[model samples]
Target: MPFIDIKVIAGVFTPEEKQKMVEEVSEAVIAVEGEALRPVTHVVITETPSGAWAIGGKALTAEDVQTKRAA
Candidate 1:
């Protein structure tokens, strides 16, 4: 049984993207831990409210993330 936790800024990823993330993450774990753990492999995603995430002392909101991604 493996538990994976992922956190990101809110509104940065669409529901479909999150679903893809969960699927890919689970597959990666299965490849390393074997298929038997498929049912037990857990991938949890947490989203912090906009402007709540920070980097290098700078707070980043959802718009900031989009801006950075575009650049």
Candidate 2:
């Protein structure tokens, strides 16, 4: 069985949209893997918010950039 893991910004996507995305991704994987093998046994999706997301200890947010631009 093929195991696939997918990650995306959680707060940006609705629950329904997430489900559909997962389904489509899994189907594509299965198509490539072939029906003989079991479908993807595991699927993982992770979501993160822009505010909480950080790079090099600096929290990144759209508002932060917008404020800088306004200055």
Candidate 3:
């Protein structure tokens, strides 16, 4: 079985978006690993607490990231 783990800041994506992401990621792996492996390919998406994840030694939440991006 192939295990795929994806981590992201919590609240960064909606439930529907996450589902799409999982499906897309799984499909990508299947394309490379073969169609037979689709049933056995495991994809895990984990969301860490927003402020708990950091960049450049600064802690920030998804909202902060979006606001900054808009600037």
- lDDT ranking from best to worst? 1, 3, 2
Residue-wise C-alpha lDDT for candidate 3, range 1-71, written one tens digit per residue: 88999997887788998899999999999999999999999999998898998889999899986687579
What's the TM for model 3? 0.87
What lDDT does each candidate get? Answer: 0.93, 0.68, 0.90
Task: Tell me how far the alpha carbon of residue 32 in candidate 3 is from the true structure, in angstroms, after superposition.
Answer: 0.3
- Predictions ranked by TM-score, top down? 1, 3, 2
lDDT string for model 2 (1-71, tens) is 77777765445556897789778877787777876754445677776666787779998675664566569
Weakest lDDT window of 10 consecutive positions for candidate 2? 5-14
- Model 3, position 12, has a per-residue lDDT of 76
Indicate which candidate wins on lDDT.
1
> Candidate 1 on 1-71: residue-level lDDT in tens?
79999898999999999999999999998999999999999999999999888899999999999998889
* RMSD value for candidate 1: 0.9
Those runs of model 2 whose alpha carbons end farther than 4 Å from true positions after fitting are 52-71
Q: How well does candidate 3 match the true structure, expressed as C-alpha RMSD?
A: 1.8
